[model samples]
Target: MSAFPKRDFRASMTWLHSWAGIIPTLLFFAVFWMGTLSVFDKEIDRWMQPESRYAGPPIAYDLDASIETFIGAQNGVEVTSLFIMPPKPREPYLYFYGVLAEEVNGKTYSYGRFVGESNEMLGEPQSLAGSGFIFPFHFKLHIPGNFGYYLIGAVALAMLVLTVTGVIAHRKIIADFFTFRPTRKARRVTLDLHNLMGVVGLPFYFLFALSGLYIFAGWFAALPMQTVDGVMGKSPVAFLELADSQSPKRRPRAGQSIAMDKAIMPFKTQAEALWSERYGAPVMADRVRIEHYGDANATVIVHRVFPGRRVTMAQDRIDFDYATGTVLYDQQATPATATRSWLEGLHFVQFEHWPLRWLFFAGGAAGCILTATGALFWMRSREKKAGAQPFNIRFVHAMTVGSVTGIMLATGVFFVANRFIALGALPPGIAPIEWEPITFYIAWLLSFIHAAARGRSAWMDQCFFIAILSLSAAVLNWVTTGDHLIKTMTTGMWSIAGMDLLLLLTSALSAWSAIHLRGKARQRPFAVQGDDPALQPAE
Candidate 1:
């Protein structure tokens, strides 16, 4: 029975799915590409920050040495509630991050980096390649303020809508899963690929969208309260205190300072001991957070996660009164909180699992394929009508080219810029780390302009650019860093090697696509497409 008998509900669903997916297809592709890159964010960081790829032995977990190093390296810039990250298998850099006692250049937090083992300060990082750039771009799109969150939230919501409407519009969802016609016409072939990917990767699409929404719920929930807090003249975090009653609250400083000689770093060892005994495993420490540092009310929280053992990143920790050896809070996740953690863990994949990481990479790639193919199918279906509505079809075609291949081209530029941009040659005002993303955004904008100018030929031109950029980035990585495939492979630095391999693979694929598109253009010399078929069954 039709849900609305007056209107063909399935036809309405088909229309809804087409327009809804079409509207944000480019944005969806951007998010999918960034999210995929973020899967190995740390590995990319290692590759970009060549200084971090230390050849020396791993640092013996000396909490005291880390403390001494942190203090002397600060150079009198007051920092509070310090968070110290030690060397791990994936992340080799010893990172000292904390809130500045007083804001500088409109920034509240300051970060200090050092080689993972040696205490020599490396100063500012070469670039914010991974954790600082690509990872954040996935959720935020680098849009300023809460607007990015709101916009991404709306896009995620649209994804859920598109997924449902697509399923409802499909007359035979089951058969579509097993059907993809490579030998068919371009219009039919893209539709088949779109259906095949959408069916196969549906769960990943749904869950990623849902989980991303959940992960940002608190920020969304904070909007109304932020307005109220603004009116009431309270600190922004005042909402968190009211909402988060589960964890211990931040204490006010008692104003009494401790001597520099006082060493409370041993608490990490004690906390690990208590946690290992409670959890029935030998758990090592990941990082330690010293809250209210140098004050009488100081406290220390040591954190760890059982990466290979559990998928739930529960953040098993023991909080201590830093002045004394007293366990203040030994945390155990509540049932409700554990449920939330499992959902978040599924989305973030913070734990170390190679196979699961690759699975997520595949899922993200599948999203990109489905979205791109769906958009292409729409363009193909509209070709016969192009003569009547030239502007609309042409406009969307330009968008399709820019958003699909343009983002890929821009990312290649980002990688290449990291290697080639000389620190000293940069304009007087621009910092090295800040310059790379600037190059990325500029490259991306130029892509849209090129697409608008070149029309349908833009697709072939951009693919060629994509291939050359990918190949250039790989060559630059070797030329600048001297870490080619053979060097990195023999040295057991698989992460760097993996990045090179991915770039080469992208080059191969884009070159093939460029060649294929070029051949099609030659055969037609005009239309490049034989027919304008309506969306139809493959088999």
Candidate 2:
């Protein structure tokens, strides 16, 4: 129980906790904040894309038809492979992809949307939408070249350090779990919330951080496999193929090209009969993949499971030899890999459990609050030294304002812009859908500038702006789509209705916080989480 002198250990831990908590606070907030929003990413996709909100009878897709369409009219491009995502809730369109022959385009992929059972292709994506923009930003921060992976990995590591040191730094976590002081002075109230969020969210914080680290640094754990590959002088992809049996296995294209109908012959009936027996029931193919397009030896794979019925990221799939319909491999995760998949699934929240999804949202929001308050509390606690370091205090406050309220403001604007810009009125050269992200970044950059210029007053101002944007976006959705809350609620479109309800709640909360801050400012200007000498605690 006792490894080192308790007092000294606690002292060191407290010191570490304070700095570690603040150093990566901005990136940490961004990750959790975006990740929380990503919980409803597909729902948000429906909100952002009107075509995606189509409410029609369920439709089926034909792989042979899709393959025929791809190979027939792509002009000089020889299709090597295909991926098809069938219509699903909030995503009621068939998405089809074609991988070009290696010599044809050096292994490039092109994709389009198909509205119904017909094999006709709809042109490029209408918008980035939530799944494309918000979800990727959660893990990548929009950074390229795997740098984002490493950066996020580092932040997760810091969170683990902060979590451990916080446990050791303070001994009254149980008390703090039940403690929050709303009526006290701003500093005391902030500190109580900081402790309370830390206590109540300890498990959530630890598990998410741990899982996120493992996901990004999983390659680090594969060092042994990498070493084995290096020793064997094998392409690293072979290790991946061994690890994931359902992943596409490549066979060199034998110059003997075949017709599209012949290449897709094995998938239409024989494959379905096989999978139906394998699962002990009829199976609906979720997506299909192929390799060595139009070649006699091409491999075809079908993924059948969706993420709704299980907590794990469903990867149930079977591979087939193209011409013969003979089963090549069926995915079966080993115990170790299954555990890893669960850890990843837990962090990603891809499952369809509503209660757990909301809890994850709550935990992520709590983390945001914890990091924000912890930073503010540290600043207030060091008020004496703050005079000697005005620039640093101001810098920290600016970062907090920009990272917290600023990002929320930007997202609200993004949603609002999606409705306002639907009429396709962008100036020459810029596409209509392209303006969505352009507006988002412009709004975000301006938020940081506003925070820097307004100093301590920016928080309340931006809170009011967030409220305005949220309310505006919700109302505009009604104005444009005629899918008001009542209509969606009655029509059984709970996903859209739920998102609308959340928008209203966001507006209400932001407005209340702004009004509260204004009232406190009238009582003592710059009162809550601000530097005011008259409000300082008597030591």
Score every model by TM-score. 0.91, 0.86
For residues 1-539, what per-residue lDDT tens digits would candidate 1 score against the true structure?
A: 65433547887888778888889988899999899999889888887777777544555545566677766766676766677777777776677766568776655555666675566666657688887789978987877556666778988999999889989987778766699889877778888899889998999999999989988895456556455333221322233333432354556678898754556567877877877787788777787778777778887878775344567766677778777768887777667777767778888877778899899999999999999999988876776446678788788988988899999999988888888553245666877878889989999999999999998789899999999998988888888778899989988888888889998999999999999999988876653356533454221
RMSD to true structure for each model, in Å: 3.9, 5.4
Cα distance off (Å), candidate 1, residue 443: 0.8
lDDT of 2 by residue, 78-154 (tens): 77666666676557777766655544333255666766666676765667778878887888687744567678888
lDDT value for model 1: 0.77
Best by TM-score: 1
Q: How far is candidate 2 from the true structure (C-alpha RMSD, Å)?
A: 5.4
User: Local distance difference test, per candidate?
Assistant: 0.77, 0.74
Give model 1's clash tally.
0
lDDT of 2: 0.74
Which pairs of residues collide in candidate 1? none
Q: In angstroms, give how far residue 346 of model 1 lies from its true place.
A: 1.5
